[model samples]
Target: MHILALVLVVLPLAASQLIGGPTTVDVNRDDVQQMASFALTQLNTLLGSQNTLVSVVQAKTQVVAGIKYFLTLDIKNGKETQTCTVTVWSRVWLNDKQVTQHACTSRTKRDGLVGATTSVNVTRTVLKMATYAVTTLNGLQGVHNSLDQVISAKTQVVSGTNYFLKIRMSDGSQTQICDVTIWDQPWSYMTQMTHHSCVNAKRRDIGMPGGLFNADINSPDVKNMTNFALGELNRLQGAQNSIIEVISAKTQVVAGMNYFLKIRMSDGSQTQICDVTIWDQPWTHMTQMTHHSCVNAKRRDIGMSGGMLNADVNSPDVKNMANFALGEINGVQNAQNSMVQIISAKTQVVAGMNYILTMRLKEGDKTQICYVKIWSQPWLHRKEMTEHSCSQVTKRAGGLLGGVTNLNVNSGDIKEVAKFAVREINGIQGAQNSLVKVVKAGYQVVGGFTYVLTLSLKDGDKTQLCEVNVWSPAWTMARRLTDHHCTAQTKRQLAAVTDADVNDHFIQMLAHYAVQTINTLDGTHRAYVELISAKTQVVDGTNYFFKIRVRQGTTTQLCDVTFWRQVWMNSMGHVTEHKCATVRRRNVGGVEPAHLSAPLQQAVSFAEDALNGKMNSMFRFVVEKVENISQKASSATTYSFDLHLVSSTCRNNGNSYGKGITDCTPNYGMLQRMTCEVTVEYRPSSSRKYSLAADKCGQIQLV
Candidate 1:
């Protein structure tokens, strides 16, 4: 027989409480089988000899954690037709000691022929073989404990197979105490250590002592015998009953609420049974009673449910349900209940007590047995009922169970809700236009069937769970719940909007507009421009003005634009500057508004002369007010501005000695009275200055 390597090494440590050695103890069936096989091989070899036809007939092994165990073998040995029945008992002590004893009786023929009998005393051989097996176990420990030497080990058997071990080792600073089981006991023990180094003594109470002895509950063979009974139940109930998908099996063990399963049998017939029968305790004889602990209950005591989804223990369903429960149970943080096991399964109904379903199927001379653990009442407190009881029985072989199509509310739809929420929160009008990204979706169980799913949404730097909905299996509709639960919290160590992020976005927009403006200004049809740098100033903590430094083949110009939140609340009614809208506030280096006044014309002429190298002077103009005439797009792109210039000034390069002597100054009153109808074209560009898109500069008319 093949055994896992981990089982070989780990199970022996658990043997301490039973066989006595270390604080850690774990037992496996393979170890017991190995011991039995080894003892039988030695005995078979010793018993074989001349003038004797000795052949091994049958061998069996029994191992219990806290009990002395034995391997029994029946052999037939005789000459000619005469035969003798020989019984062999291979026993092992708790301390890794092995011993074997045999009793033989010869059968004489009715013809009066005497059978030749030999007296055999195999004491020395048995003791030698026992010593050898014990020595082999000792050798195994040497390698097993090579990492951590067991300084001292003390064990105390509680009552039955339950026991505790106290051990001190040189590897750790503290002594380790743990509870273990002997011989595959029914009680559940804490397998994990208390600390990283070793389990503490506090975990010892998790194991219970004086566990009730029910061989069918503890023995794999006896438990498997119920599979036929279960198959018979399925055959009887196969036509009328069908399986239902369970939302949750263990924690929510409500009768008529939790759904059971229907599995297709190899015969193409659906096994429609969801309940188990306890043959040891007749169902009719059962009484409606509750027990504090079902593991300690007897036939006269309380039993678990019958048809509850959680209580249905079909062979395949048992493992599937157990695995599902484990995943959900383990997800709980710092769970007091770590493991689950089904100690008893019966058809009888015990009020408010957990039980296992039992079934038996008879095929001519053979019987197929099945068992299922049912969880009811307060399931969390009854951790023992969470485990599976039908390990020995094989799952019914078939393709798959057929059921009505259940429209599972896909989690993928959460993205849509997130998009909707992002649109709502970010004021996006449609899902396609919304840039809301779903970060994660968390699900919460509601009404034991439906789920309230919350989706975390992200828009640029802002994040929130903007969308929540109720989703359930078999329901086609994903009902919108609420958007109030999700609120944006700034990411850790990240401010609302970084200077770099704002700058980058602004630069990108400016680059796009600048290229377009430059192409229109210079008529070069260029697709790109060299961005010098943006000079920014914050105003009223709400608006940001950018002075874009733009250059096109050594022709550098400065342009100005302001970014601010729109005057109205976003479509979602959220007051946020997540997306900046552009406002053409002024001309280059000028405040107020843009106008085609005398000062503006003089400044324009100065700029033209400066570009032509005809004048060595810096030009300045004051824009009194500017109005955008273009329709607003998703982003600030192109805009038409009506300019009103107030004043203009020019400094003569020859007047260095006189400091700032103006070569040409426009009349302020004259510029103020005129509302310049010159259309100042602006697009997002690298240079802050707007190029003459449709230069009708001198066409300014007085308002």
Candidate 2:
């Protein structure tokens, strides 16, 4: 049966009458013949047999197939044709039995046509699946091309504007859209065509602004898209798989200050855009703000009134406030100077007869300033002046007599002048002779009344003369005479001179009464004389006096003693005074006295008292009294004694034999028995005492 059907369907062409009129068909029309042949070729390929169906033209514009009218082809001539809707139908044959039939219609066309009918062989077709696929691919390519243009334009805009861009796909089933970005240069084609199945199935809406579509080719948006596509291509090149969605970026200014921007993808996910600006000194931003822009949208947010942005900010760490205050204080302290004048002094006497006086000065109550000059003339003279002498003497000497005179006041006061003259006179006198001798003569007014003189005169015409004259005040003259000349000289000669003389003539005379006293005894029952010698010797041809005091017991009976001597060269080669009595007791006792020098009398008195008791105990004596022997040479003396009873009492203390004296016998002993011999010598012609002893005398002593 299938083979009979195939043979009957493969017959040659035949014609049928039209219902309206007889219509001719062009079997070889160029357009009609080509379409018919194409339709038949497709049918044969699909059925795997060349004779799958037979087409018969029953009328001029109608074609019939084995089981159904497959198609009606018409060629019409008109200015404007009616709406023509053409239906296409097909029947399927399996094992020579009809299985099913299908039909499809072409869209109605109302455009004008200018072609005539032609006899054409026709085959019907339900829409071909390969054609639909080809159509879909072509549509995708077209959409991609258009979208690439849009993306390129948007990228250029976005890149120039410092923005980022992305595209996505979505399915409308979920509340949140699932998005897939094409990641190619063009996003619109993927949006419209490649994603059509998802778009159509979900009936999803795509959102992209018309202004974005009109973006400048050179804009940053387009550039961003270009960059996005390039990056995605690089990511997908090896694996060809990657997810695309929202893109994100961040920017910061200061730590807490910055700008943020967000863009939403088609899937309702968001991207962040950030820009950072760091602010230091002299910071500046390149973009300018305009009136139309929001505060954050402005290129530079500085100098605006309403936001948290600040321009020309300053730091609080480096302000200098204290230095200005110190400058003011220093300016006031440089203007004050009145506390600086002398306070007290201490002094010490140094060598060269000068005194060192230190005067302390003060700045205030507590500060001591040293090295100030405070003392005046008199104190200066007492303190610092050296003792000196003027070699030249006054022509007319004799003003105030010898105490201290010739007080030549040059620049100093009375005290200074007096001190100067006293020291001068003393120095001159001391250079000539012993100061003791010069003071002995007392003060003499000489060389007229203009000068005072101190004379040191020797017995042989050697004289040391010091002349002092005061041209001014008398007190100065008196001070010079007393302090330096008479006062010092008297002190030096104090042992030799009497207190009377010292009080009457020397300055500071009260000092003499304190000297130690000397004692003496007289065997002749008369007062003994005291002589005090000077420690120093006189110069050549000079004379010195020994001071004398005659006392009876504790009473000073008389002081009327003079010192006189005969000048003689002694055997010891020294010229000293020879013996003679120069002073005597004024009242006399009844006994006639042997004439002896006062020195000899004093020596005799000393020996008598010292030996009196011992001698009396050793010898027995009657009523005969002791006396000075006479009737001999003036330098020699002899004694005689008469003994009457030869008694044991006359023995010398039971050790020797001697004649005893009766009541009327004279108590004179032999001159040899009463005297012992002694000789004293000294070298260099000085007076010093040496001791002499008697052999077997059992301690004979000399003074």
Maximum-TM-score candidate: 1
Report RMSD (Å) for each prediction in the order shown: 34.8, 73.0
Model 2 poorest 10 in a row by lDDT: 311-320
Residues 373-472, candidate 2: write the lDDT tens digits: 1112333443212221111122344345434333332323533433455455534444333322222212224221223333343223333323233332
Off by over 4 Å in 2: 1-482, 486-503, 507-537, 540-544, 550-703
Report the lDDT tens digits of candidate 1 across residue range 1-703.
3578878887876664443221211223554445445544444343332223333232333334433333322333444332322222333453453433332333445532222333332122222222222233335334221111112222211211111222221112222322221111212322222211235323222121111111212112222323433334334334233222211111001110111112212222332222222222111222111100101222222112332222333333343334334443334322323223432123333454344433332334433332334454434544244533212223444323321122233456555545555444343222232334443344433211222333445546655433343323222232333222333435652123323232243344434443344333333322222233333222222233344443322233444434442111122111122211222333333333224454344334333332222211122233445444343333333334454443334332333222111433554432312233343333455464434434223322211
**C-alpha lDDT (0 to 100) for residue 210 of candidate 1:** 11
What TM-score does model 1 achieve against the real structure?
0.16
Residue 224 in candidate 2, Cα distance off native in Å: 99
Q: What's the CA error at residue 518 for candidate 1, in Å? A: 80
C-alpha lDDT of candidate 2 relative to the true structure: 0.24
